[model samples]
Target chain A: MALKLYLDRMSQPSRAILTFCKVNGIEFEEVKIELAKLQNYSPEYAEVNPMKQVPAIVHGEFKLFESHAILIYLASAFSGVADHWYPADLQKRAKIHSVLDWHHSNLRRGSATYIFNTTIALAFGQPLNLEAAAEGEKILIASLAKIESFWLQDDGPFLLGNSQPSIADLSMACEVMQLEVVDTKDRDRILGPRKRILKWVEDTKNATAPYFEEIHSIIYPAKEKLQKLKTMAAKKEPQSTGEPA
Target chain B: MALKLYLDRMSQPSRAILTFCKVNGIEFEEVKIELAKLQNYSPEYAEVNPMKQVPAIVHGEFKLFESHAILIYLASAFSGVADHWYPADLQKRAKIHSVLDWHHSNLRRGSATYIFNTTIALAFGQPLNLEAAAEGEKILIASLAKIESFWLQDDGPFLLGNSQPSIADLSMACEVMQLEVVDTKDRDRILGPRKRILKWVEDTKNATAPYFEEIHSIIYPAKEKLQKLKTMAAKKEPQSTGEPA
Candidate 1:
């Protein structure tokens, strides 16, 4: 059976997976789950992923969720080369694993908040809070700087100097791309004031552009609308208690 | 050069790494980094890990951080057994990997906030937020429910059916043990709210008691002080940051 992928382009993880599969010449049917309409909470969709996070896969009898896991699973199931995609040698993979883990809590988590919060500001007619925006920018820069100094300093388009991008690039690229959906065209202003990240992000994105293109249409428009709706929802209920503010 | 494990016992991740090394008979010098005082911000440490979260290891020239990454690395490096510990098969390992990843964000994160806020509650004079105590109960129960429905049901005594515990058990055991440090011992209330989870926690701790001895010291003090300091801190800060009383 050909593999089936569940995705919503509005989600960065979904885009990363879509881009990766397309870029690597792996085949799959991409099924869109519309988040703007709350399709993720549908009983049918909930059976696939109770957490309702995106970029999951169904391969014959196998079911998988979590983008990092999906990225690795696809790479392994398709390519059969562990080399640097996720190195087979003990320590190199561990470093990749360590950075990947950090991406969620520190880099991705903080950056997502900055992007989402700015979108919130745009929707609500509120100016972006300088303090929160500044903090987010600092964290994004620090995280990117780490990637630059530790992994990308070899002066190549790819993160680890491999001709092709690794799962690390996939994870980071999805996050950085989400910044583009923010209301402001020049998001790096809030990301880092006069940031040094432009060079590395350009290189990383350019290297991974083919993958970026595969899922852009579905996710891009939905993400724009989600920002507008979020502001509306916030205005209706500022501290709606159970709803994530 | 022998493996050098860098840790601070106060951190649950550090303790998990320490416990895994001891249980597995892996030898290493303990390089303690004081996270409480923010030693992680130093430039030298930044050279070691840009993310700078703990349970980092310097194995000869190699450096690894993130407790889960370190655990997976140690399992692979020492050529440990496949059955009870980290397995090699694609699906089983992926399930385990996914849970550990979730734990980093959910259980571990909730507990970290619990520790910080409770410490704040103690330092600043205020009534312990019953809401915080409630939040603690909520996350832990949700974690237990997932384990019951997904990983464990009839397979008792441990997660993944190990006569001896795996790094999964070690990682979770460390975090769950910190629950004793959580200010609310309102077991009757929380258990009444979520009965199955209460039983699971009881059983998980009971099963791990054999190897759980070394960690009891750190856990006991933190938990004990949480209950002890609740009143002390309550005296310092006002309760209900929610609204003006």
Candidate 2:
């Protein structure tokens, strides 16, 4: 039986896993769990992932959640994939693991918070929580600084000094790419200062090539919708109920 | 040269790594980073880990941070250790990785927040943030429920159903054990509703044996101190400065 992957394109981890499968030529069924429609909360999907999160895979009867785990599993189970994506060398592999683990609490958390406070809140027509956005920016800045000075400090382009990109690179680059949904000013202020991080993100995108672009195609429409919503909000008259729509 | 491990026994991940090394008989020089003393912020220690977090290891010349990564590294780099702690079988290892990756934002985050709001705040003679503690309790409750219903639903004693416990078990057990510092009322309200989780924690402690108890011995004093501080605050007259101290 072929592997099964449940994902929503809008999610960073989902894109990371989808790109991995596409780049590696791993055949799998992509089951879309649309976040906007709250499809993940459905009973059937929850069975596959009780956490109701995207980027879960079912390989035969073995089901796995957590994108990094799925990535590592795919790399280990499949034969003939490029070894650099998740190296077999003990030290190199461990370093990749280190970055992936550190990511959950740092980069991923910061990026998700920043996007939620700025972009998602606007999309939903909710008032921006400036305090929360400020906090998220703080975390995002600190996380980016750590990535530049620590993870990307090595001479090579990829994390852990690899000539080829690894799963850690894919996971983190996808996370930073999420900032695309925010307005130009907020996005620039948060991500603009980091030159090395920008280059590394570009390098990772190049390494993944067409699949990266293909999987991330949905971001355009999403960004467009957010822009339209912002413009509409600015021109709207004050309503009796104080609601935008 | 012996491997160097930078850890503060008070931290959960640090305890997890320390116990792993002790159980496996991996010779390591324990470099204590006294978190309370702000030693982790020192210029010297920041070079070891720019994040300034405990549970970093220097194996030979290679430096690694993040306890999960260090655990995986130690499991792979060393020989003669029990395989079940970090199984080499592809499916089994992937499942362990899945649990470890899911753990960070869910279990560890909630548990740390609960401990900090209730116990650590008291220890510092700071007024408890009731709102944050309530929020942390909600997360902790949901997390514990997930552990029982999803992860512990397996028929076997351990997380992945092996007779022996895996590193996931150690990391999670340590996280839950942190609630020991909270007063009984708050702790019971948060943890007492869960039966299976308690049993699983006890089973994990038994499986890890003397090493788990030995490493966690410091918690007793800390818990006692927090209790005494709470009692002292309750009995004292209102302070002139409008603070507990």
Candidate 3:
């Protein structure tokens, strides 16, 4: 039986894993778990991953979740994966691991929270939290600054100055892709000054090619829907209740 | 040159790395980075870790940060470290990685945020954010429930039902140690129902032995100071500003 990949393209990590399998020529069956529809909360999906999050995998009798772990597993367990993605050298691998771990608490947290508060919250029937969005933006900007000044400081095009794209590169670039859902002006303001991050992300996307573009196609429509929601919210009249529309 | 571990015991991840080194008998020089004094923000420390975080390492010329990454590096690069800590098998290692990544977004986020909002925030000269503390507690409770039902479901005493403790176990148990600083009633309310988590933490502490206990000694004093602060705050009179005393 081939490896089974449970994912939802709407998720950044899910897209990373999907692109990883495609780029590496890893054989896997794609299983979509729709988060918007609450498919991830289903009991059957829970059996596959008790965590009930997408981008999980099952191979034979073994099961795993967490995109970083899945990417590492695919890179190590598969036959044809390039070495630079997850090198055998202890020092190089350690640096890559450092970037991956940093992404969870820093970049991922900021981007995900900012996008959710500014745009996705309304789609889920929640009000836009301007305060939380402001807080998230602070973290997001700091994280991007760190990426430009430190992670991308070396001459190499990828994070930690790796010449070739690692799983960290793919994972982070996909996370940055999430900013697309924000208003055009807001997204530009956040990413504008970080030239190195812009170039690095573009470089990573180009390096991965058509698969990267293909996997991220879902984000475009979501972005459009969010913009429309914002316009509609702006047009609403103020009521005596003084509640957010 | 000896391995240089830059750490501050007051930090949980720092303690995790320190304990791991002693347990594995990895020879190292401990360089204290006092977060309370803003030592992490110093230019000199930034040279070592641009992220300005504790639990960084400088091995010869290569520098690394993020405790999960450091632990992975130590387990693989060192000769005496046992395989159970980070196994050679692809699946076992992948499962371990899953837990470590999950720790950052879920367990670590919940515990650290809750503790900081409830206790450490005031120590840093910020007022207690009861709202943030309440939110953090919700996440913490859900995380504990997941750990009990899934990660510790197997017969084995440690996370993922491992007979031998892994890096994930040490990292997570150390994070739970942060809850010791919370109000005794609040701490018990959060953890008392999670019997499996309590046992697993004890098992992990015993497995790591004197090193775990020795590294965590700092938390006790910090806990006392916070309790005193809470007691003093309760005695303050109501003022027109309605500010938290």
Q: Which of the numbered candidates is closest to the native, going by highest DockQ?
A: 3
User: Candidate 2, which CAPRI tier?
Assistant: high
DockQ metric, candidate 2: 0.81
Model 1: lDDT of residue B96: 66
Q: Which one is best on TM-score? A: 3
Worst 10 residues of 2 chain B by lDDT: B236-245
Candidate 3 lDDT tens digits, B1-245: 56999998989999999999999999999999988778999999999998888989999998999999999999998999999999999999999999999989998998887888788865765567666776678888888888888888576888888899999999999999889889889989988887888888888889989889888888889899888877676576221121234
Better of 2 and 3 by TM-score: 3
Backbone clashes in model 2, listed as residue pairs: none
Evaluated at residue A69, the lDDT of candidate 2 is 96
Ranked by TM-score, the better of candidates 1 and 2 is 2
Candidate 3's DockQ? 0.91
Top-down lDDT ranking = 3, 2, 1
TM-scores of the models, in the order given? 0.82, 0.92, 0.94
- Native contact share for candidate 2: 0.93
TM-score of chain B of each: 0.77, 0.90, 0.94
